[model samples]
Target: MAFPMQAGPGENGVDLPSTARMHDYWLGGSHHTEGDRAFADHLAMVGPLIPYLVRTQRALLRRIVRYLLGQGVRQFVDIGSGLPTCGQVHEVAEGSDPPARVLYVDNDPEVAADGEDLLAGNDNAAFLALDFREPDRVLSDPAATRLLDPQQPVALLALAALQMIPDSDDPAGVVAGYLRAMCPGSYLALTHSGPDPQLAYACEMFDQMKFGPRHALYLRDPVAVQLFFTGLELVPPGIVPLPLWHPDPERDPTLQNPGQVPVHVGVGRKPGFVD
Candidate 1:
């Protein structure tokens, strides 16, 4: 009972779908392959409101970085950094008082390749082929140290990526391992998909559910999502449904409906750290 060899899709013949491609399709972007399209369309048809929920999660990440910069953080390790994003971590850093250095990590070679191409000829930035599940490898990579000084206060971003790890990978432990490896002053910026009871329960209604029988998952509850932030001090407003966590208030008027868009997000600091 082995899963078919899933490659990083566009990068080789191993034949696998990527979180990045699925996201691209969700954002109405065209970089996805036929496989990506099929999955996205299926998920949308099932819930009929997943894309908007997906974008709100991105908004949550933006809010977290702006808050982190306000706290004097000057370095970032954006694990799960996938395809080129608009006004991402580096952009948010530059918009702050003292610029921050950032390291982007991902296991998909195609994602790492695309990231490198997007940041072509730029300094103050670097991307590595690393997976969040392997925190030790991510923390020890030469490139990680090259672009950032861990001793300095830093922020780690998991944003919408943790669910990709299967239950067997020990997702909670993986999160704890990263926190221990980060300097005390480090921060974690995050978001994740969660289940809502009224969102259509018909199996027949589900089109892609792409992770298929084992490819994807959702946190399902606030407690499960909050457990990932264990041993950290939550920033004011704490972990709550995405749109409710310090949003623009004037953000998009469309965000008023909780059911149409669902997500859980938060920002936490490793206690026992200083500015």
Candidate 2:
């Protein structure tokens, strides 16, 4: 499924690198351009552990989906879902006993266009071209309302995406808005890069990259990251490094190295009545 790298004239122009595409490239996916690869390679040079960190993030998403499936969650809203690569939410969630419904959201024109095309024949899944910051719009969007029942438990995934939402955007409020609209048993699985002293040089390098403000990275402390899960109850290992979150021996065999990854991951449940 080869998607257009450049969605249209001036939309996702080949001149600019896409953060989503770079992520795909880091995960060894084929949906990225040379510019994306170059950026990823630069990151790897600055922070040799970044590629491994990304892989860890990917493993966590898979684990979270499987865990949600085990809990009988059949609907998902993956906000800021980048380009559809391997182990997408739909594939993992639908693989359960009863297939799941997924609505992927992204403001990137290229991602939305390609995502809709990717799920063309899949009735249970869809993609929306919307920003996650506007929780009201996202919750009320026709596609999301049509596919997901707000009265039921829907797994909301903010994986690796929240970092793109800077402090001025009031990301915490955005998360709370989603939680308020969700039913009691609904779950929120999120992962964000944590501030690390070891990554100072990498951070410097990232600052130099001078990507668009939308693509700029924001590394938040545990306290700030935990705020996103404010009203929810953490599952376990509360806001630990990505490798420590429900460390699945099979999926992730290298949990022994706790400090290997600088990303933080967690899953929390919204307290209330369950349907």
Candidate 3:
């Protein structure tokens, strides 16, 4: 579905480029403005692998939802969910035996508004406008409570989302708060940009360009990313590059060379047996 792009900094309030819009552009969606396109093009020039990284991250998200569905997780909380698009959590979960409940959370007003409209008439899914850093607000929101059962297992997805949060915001703490809020047997499927030497120039460009005034990119090392899964049991193939994590050869035929992707992804389950 194409989102309407208005002149000037629409609804989101930031004059600078928006990460969500640029991501949409990279995904070949028509939800971005000219400024977002230009910013994405400039970044692509510096790091040609960026678009590939974005696609691989999206592929991993689909894999994650399917994996969770296999584990009998019927509820999902997708934090920092950007523009609604094909292969989103709810779309992937639509055919499950017991219908899945998906709650999409985003701090962007435009994303939230668009999501609410897109999910209209879909009783199993809803969207909330809240910052992922504020776990309390997200978990306490009426939409979340209405769709998610506190007693059941849930899959908390943060695909390519945590990288937008800087270090000073205590990303680890933010993750921990969500873990605390989720019940036992729940899962956390997350993907974050890794600190790749090849992308140093692009990283510098992001810092200097200030692509999004509200969102800053932060690439963390594997050791640091692992800390976010504290007190949880990581699934097999722990913290590997996006394609390497539970890869489905049939689905990702084009992802031949997985080593080129510089995003770390993994799923960790809370330490408790599901009754």
Candidate 4:
């Protein structure tokens, strides 16, 4: 059980770059400590492409959120959602009509604390300590249950986090289980890292970091990644590289789809009834 506002070195190590803070640092957020930046900077040493890839992934997220909102989704459960930043889901969701009720799920206490402090007044928002790998426990979290109504259409958004799970813990199965338990009409929006050839050589360098590269399963092919949405009906245009998925021609390619795009994104709907 994690609590909000607590800060310390984690059991794995202190102040090192875990996925949450690394992402926190990349997104130009303040919650990340120096150690987090150190690791992220180290990753930059691996290749210039890493940072560009990170930023593009974020842009894809922004595009996806707007698209989902346009499609009438009013509820969202964002797993592995890192620290706060501009152009984030909440900002995009509320910026549109039919305001979204969002539940942010991340195991980091500091992120939760910051969210609680910053987003407390929001009637439609709350944050909970949730590990994406542990769906059972996450679904049980009060913040998740209270804000998200399973009977209604809820967007299950997991981006850049699924790679943390190896075969021993099936992220796809986790997604399937979550969808199985939710009422039909629920949507799953996901973006996961894939092995772009350019990123391959950087793998060894990441291994020595605070969170070893060995812990990551980043080589999922497009076909393998598609398994995550097995039972659901993919929105028209189906699963595709992030760049080609609902592109807005008005936006510059650099900002719209930057660097070597290594993530695969899609929105799938669980077919059934709303009851």
Candidate 5:
């Protein structure tokens, strides 16, 4: 059976719920549509703790970006970068002593549009519409190359977005391809929903969602998540729950219960020279 036609801005068919938009709503962003809000509300009903988990993931992204900046990484390629909400990559990176340059990539046109508007005056940031599964497309984009120095270390953010890349898309290969293209000393900070016992029931709920099969969530175990960083050297406290991966008490007082997030995160560095 064919899924109902889904439409985005300017499309005539019924407006479909977008994962990016729904995620924006979860993060208290203003870019989501009514349909996105409805879906988010439904998600809350089924997985009451989902919003909190989302918040935790977002906070973790901030911490990771800060850590990358401290490591002297000033270029970032944010694949699957969703709607530009508060505390976005550029905001976090550029806020550092030496600002960082970032390329925000997302497949959703609406998200691309919003990102463009949000990054309008920031010369350090650029938004491009590209499916993250196509690592070559992301790396080869003219804008990405223009803004980021290939010889310098870079940070590739794959947070919370990999779970949406179904197994058939060769998620592992896609990640490896990105790592291969990045210069040595580049870092990949990734987070994903996992098959935690506490959230097993949420998986079933997500399966029943009407957002279309392509947007369905694919939960992986810790081993599978770690596989994405195969050749790269994982940072300390490797592949642990979101809060447990270098949780900063100053940034988030909720570190008291790292397990409450119900997701896994890790940072891996492409091995070799970095300048």
Candidate 6:
């Protein structure tokens, strides 16, 4: 399903395939272009487990949000949030008593636009177009200030998003910036692609394929991913493979073979607060 290399702009003058849209395509969402499908298909052909990996990450997100809700964290800031689809934070959060306040952030203009449209009538959620690397901008944005209270605990989610950030951009520092703005009881729920042989080959293929700008994945080892949670207390079962993190048999029946997925996930709580 290779798309011919055509030299023309796509919708919204996007000449390159978008990673967000590719993710949407992987998750069986309709908000994707032919280019996105082509690129996603190419990677899936290389890794074979990519579709499963994507779904596993999504499942992990659902479980993480549920866990956060249980912890009484009512505000959520989902950085690098892609197209709002199934199992989105707002959907899962709003299902609980006293619907959680959510602020979705993404640098992609198209994704941000779609999110704005999706959340138009919903007062509990809002979308902000900003790069996660710019934590100050994300935290200072009116949407964040309005939806999330700085004095209260917040669940900051970076799921499957940090791998897109390269080392040169100071990924750990970026995490620190966001945590610095959060209250002591706040938590960071993160999932990053691990540095495995198969994933390395897939990344190589992705780079060779040249899907688009900022699409190159930076795989990190478990130790490296752990650094993202530097000062926080890792919740029990720290930094494990996707399927191993708080698996709910009833909800995630299809998830099998724990410790097999190359994506690392965990939730770390900021210290210095009680209740």
lDDT of 1 by residue, 206-236 (tens): 5244335333344446788888888888987
lDDT for predicted candidate 3 compared with the true structure:
0.78
- Candidate 3 is scored at a TM of 0.88
Write model 2 residue lDDT over 47-105, tens digit each, in one string.
67766776777787888898888888999989888876777888777667678999888
TM-score of each: 0.82, 0.89, 0.88, 0.84, 0.88, 0.89
How would you encode candidate 4's per-residue C-alpha lDDT over 1-275 as one tens digit per residue? 00011132233333455555666566676766787777667767865676666666677778888888876788888887765464668987877676788888777666667667768788888887666667778877787778777778878988766765676787788887677667788899887766676666666545554334334344677788789988899986887777777776676264454335776778899887765
Locate the minimum summed-lDDT window of 10 residues in model 3.
Answer: 1-10
**225, model 3: CA deviation in Å?**
1.1
How many residue pairs clash (N, CA or C atoms closer than 3 angstroms) in each of the candidate models, in the order given?
Answer: 3, 0, 0, 0, 0, 0
Q: How does candidate 6 fare on TM-score?
A: 0.89
Query: What are the RMSD figures for all models against the true structure?
Result: 4.3, 4.0, 4.0, 4.5, 3.9, 3.8
Q: Write the per-residue lDDT of candidate 6 for residues 69-89, one digit (tens) a residue.
A: 999999998987877776789
Candidate models: Cα lDDT each: 0.68, 0.77, 0.78, 0.69, 0.77, 0.79
Candidate 1 wrongly placed segments (more than 4 Å): 1-18, 28-39, 198-204, 207-214, 251-254
Point out the worst 10-residue segment of candidate 4 by lDDT. 1-10
Which residue pairs clash within candidate 1? Answer: 42-208, 211-215, 211-216
lDDT of 4 at 97: 71
Better of 3 and 4 by TM-score: 3
C-alpha-based local distance difference test score of model 2:
0.77
The reply for model 5, stretches above 4 Å from the true place, is 1-16, 203-214
Backbone clash total, candidate 6: 0
lDDT of 6: 0.79
lDDT of 3 by residue, 1-275 (tens): 11112222235544555667777888888777888788778777767777777777777788889889999999998987877775789998899989999989887777677778889999999988887789998889888889988889988888867776778898889888888888899999888877777677766665577653333357787888899899999999999878899989889863688887777887999988767
Q: Which of the two, 2 or 5, has more TM-score?
A: 2
Worst 10 residues of 5 by lDDT: 1-10
